[model samples]
Target: MVGRLRARANASMWVAPALILVLVFIYYPIIENVRLSFFSWSAFSPEPRPVGLDNYRALGSDPVFWRALGNNIGYAVVSLVFQVGLALVLAAVLEAYVGRRLRGLLRTIYFIPAVISITVAGMLFQFLYDPHIGLVNRFLGAVGLDSLQHSWLGDQDTAIWSVIAMSQWQSIGYTTMLFMVAIQRIPAELYESAHVDGAGRIRSFFVITVPMVREMTTLLVVVTISGAFLAFNEVMVMTGGGPANSSQVLGTWLYHSAFLNDDMGYAAAIATVIFVITLAASVIQLIRAQRRRVET
Candidate 1:
């Protein structure tokens, strides 16, 4: 009884701060946000009117909302392909080819963008993409590719891509690091055995590395799905939903409606939908991962 009591006390002590923080910050805010999503209010209006399904109904018919939703999907897909895919490939190279010191040094260099704040990244991007005197345009001009040096962030067709590149620059390092860890943890014996049996690097990678890292890949996919669905910061900074709402995403649109337009109820409805979609994606990903795990 004495030992049991002491253990319990230790566990309680260890968990105390985390429990308090979760209750105060995380759970509390989540509950409040869900509550606020169902009501209508603005800056001057202190009271929120309960407009059950009207906000949702309005979003269904909103063209800007749909455009933003499409843009968010595009952002997520492109990010997944370029960001996570390239990260995986680079991580493989670093693990298989580079020495420890060199790999770590390269990783640190790549992670510099991620370590900086998003606001700073956005500001830096704005300058990099400046039409008249930007580095990208100057490089294009110098290379005799002047036709491609038009306004990047300012134009509707290219704004989202610019934001995506910015996101990729920031996030690729972390994802690459994730892949590298998973790859490094893989048993060396498997590769050694494969080498003796006539399997080349390409074949071994396909047979061993790819199958081994399925779980990490699945998790990254889930993260990408959630991040894309709830995208906000990049869109806000890079384009602010833009020259004509071309680069608008759900989060930015929600912000515009709730804060800028003072339509809290509508924003809440959008929030609720975003929450639902993200939850659905999580559930679907888990199910798929588990099925693959079982099958393998």
Candidate 2:
């Protein structure tokens, strides 16, 4: 009995450092942020004054906050459609149809943009969306679609969507690679058996490929949704939530409030909202995975 107790104690001792790091770096900051949300503070202020729920109350009436949240939701939907859904299909096609050498080359070509710095990608796309000399407009003019050309990023209506398109261009490749890895792990014999049973490629894909990669799909969905909510760099770099805050997302709005507007307390409240959303997504993923395990 003593030996078993000693072994358990030693295992805990080995885990202590990591546990401490997580508590200090992750949990402590989260708790601090939540506590800070209840206070009215600014960077210029000497101290935080307790404001109870005022900051959160303000959020309820803030039109910009609602617009930012709506943009985030739209971003999540588009990312789900293109990054998760379309990437999976592309990955499956590449894995099944392409030759090995050619597949590797194509993957490298696709993944190149993913490895590029987000800042660089943002800047590159910004120039591409410029009103006059931009490649997008030039291409439209070249193709005799000159009437369709407009200021892509400068226009209020097109600004957010243009940023989203840039993000999809940079991210689709990375998601495709992840899907390809998941698809490759599926057993070959399952596909062969499907083929033997007279199932076509598309039928086999829906039946075998997708079901087998459910875990990966779930993970990617959680990540993509959380990422969409937390998106800052691309918007900041490309539009700065600009042309009169038309493209603002939650993250940029938080930054704008905290630093630019000198409303740290309100920023903390926004942070709390982001945390709740991401945590909910994670919880949903865990519940679904557990239910699947139980069913199996």
Candidate 1 lDDT over residue span 122-175, tens digit each: 889999999998899999999999989899988989998898889888898888
- How much lDDT does candidate 1 score? 0.88
What is the C-alpha local distance difference test score of each model? 0.88, 0.95
What stretches of model 2 exceed 4 Å from their correct place? none
Write the residue-wise lDDT of candidate 2 on 46-165 in tens digits. 999999999999999998999999999999999999999999999999999999999999999999999999999999998898888899999999999999899988888999999999
TM-score of each: 0.90, 0.98
Question: What alpha-carbon RMSD in Å does predicted model 1 have with respect to the real structure?
Answer: 2.4
TM for candidate 2 is 0.98
